[model samples]
Target: MKLSELGEIGFLKKIEASLPLSDKSVLLGIGDDAAAVRVSRGKTLLSTTDLLTEGIHFDLKYISFYQLGAKALLVNISDIAAMGGIPRYALIVIAVPDNIKVAELNELYRGIKKTASSYKVSIIGGDTSGSKNSLTINITLLGEAKQGNIVSRGGARPGDKIFVTGTLGDSSAGLELLKKGKRSGYLIQRHLLPAPRVKEGVFLSKNRLAASMIDVSDGLATDLNHICEQSKVGAIIYEDKIPLSKELKKAKLKKSPLNYALSGGEDYELLFTVKASYIKKVYNAISKGRLSATMIGEITEMKKGMLIVDGKGQKMPLLPTGFNHFR
Candidate 1:
């Protein structure tokens, strides 16, 4: 009835019952330090990990166990997608609170299963343990990409156009609405389920269009600076060019929409760079989908530093306003 009675093993048994492990390559699932898998020749492996804590990363009062589980894994998949890779496997390490119900744990695993299945990835192995005060989920995802197809944060060149997939500020808008006890269908959905742009990443990698790429886990301003710092370049972003979502427009938080779009985190959209010459091709490819890529800025020489131009056409130094552990 209660979690303390069922214990970790019992909870794991219930969760494992529904896992359909059809892939023969998955030699082990849900019971080890790591999942062992056979890799095909000539493909490079991409590995990423993310940790979610109860009070820090989420508030259980507003988030469902299923959503918590789904989000824990999907966010790591987003990292692989940013590198232009296909996710193949995952290992989940969960810290459970003694008071959490066995039924709740099962619901969490169901969400994890749904997310992994949606991405065609297998949960090969994991570990479970008891924590004193809160629940924590740590997930490591492994993926593969062609040797030369992998994108990184250090490849941007001066004159390349900066583009982002989909409109921004929706997740932050959703958070704002949630905090105010107001409901906007789009914002709520955006917060609950943020889509990773895997197909778009693959398209960019295949076309050789993305010189550098990073996902908008931190706000656009912070993530873009990551590319600039790594590439040893500077950037100039135009305030008017950044795409703001319809939900953000409707929410109309006291802060300007541009501020939310630029500084609010958890958007999960892709931020990428393309040479000016290939912009047309990139635009054409994304046009086929409902999602539109907006070009908001350009890479510049290192001496220029990162700058943002306001509506008055006055340029100002851009500060990192995105998520930082220390700040």
Candidate 2:
């Protein structure tokens, strides 16, 4: 049946069923004018929102509604993970075109429900509306972290060492493969369902290991640039030090793996810095988290600027050439 027949309330009833049960943190959820939550003393909350559009951020032809729904939530959760917080609740607002079916939207809700439950997050509330154009999903996620445990992109010092949680370029490489009709399993999934580095973020934050942190949503070059901009420092990354997935390495594409590693957006891995003194302890801590990361670079004075060191130790200017929304 068409959405006009089901109307807003009818569709929302379907979405409500897909949500997880109430938790202690959630004081009130759907059916109210607004959702409410309670928090512990001495803790800070982290909030982030993202907009996913049909042609801009995603394409409906290649992306299933279910995957789109999961991804719509996952990307926002990545922001919380970047700050070393535990995701708790979310408010999703979706706008759908008339041509869309109720089944498609329910599948999308299934995707959202599965992801939220996995992260132990509650879907407190959201709004759905009819759209004249493309399908759109907007999610606002809230997470909490102890005051001291909240990591930011601006904490890096001059001598801090830069590191990344997982291999880079996989998602971007995967996207390229899909566009070319190449069905490499892992690569495509990496692009379709990128995993957030929540565990690593929490471990490092709790242990006071990371000096600065940010997720590689817009690729290593761009995200690292954000840290530098916020901290007022420059960085030098070694070409050989960047971790590239085997799948990305094996992909036959027009762009080099290094280029993908440098400019590919949506990796969702954490890129962080640790003080030189804490490098060893950080290594041990990450071992306990079962995450392997590489020390790719170091923070330097602002005058030194961002550059990439080649294998032979040649330094070249590294442009912030990752995915740009307006470009």
TM-score of each: 0.86, 0.87
lDDT score, residue 1, model 2?
85
Stretches of model 2 off by over 4 angstroms after superposition: 1-40, 287-289
Global fold similarity of model 1 (TM-score):
0.86
Residue 152: error of model 2 in Å? 0.6
lDDT tens string, model 1, 186-208? 88677767888888888888778
Q: What is the lDDT of residue 276 in candidate 1?
A: 87
In model 2, what is the error at residue 201, expressed in angstroms?
Answer: 0.7
Question: Poorest 10 consecutive residues of model 2 by lDDT?
Answer: 27-36
Clashes of each: 2, 0
The digit string of per-residue lDDT tens for model 2 on 218-325 reads 889988887887789999999999999888888788899999989988989989999988988978866676666888999998888999999999999988888765
lDDT of 1 at 170: 83
The residue ranges of model 1 lying beyond 4 angstroms of the native Cα positions read: 1-41
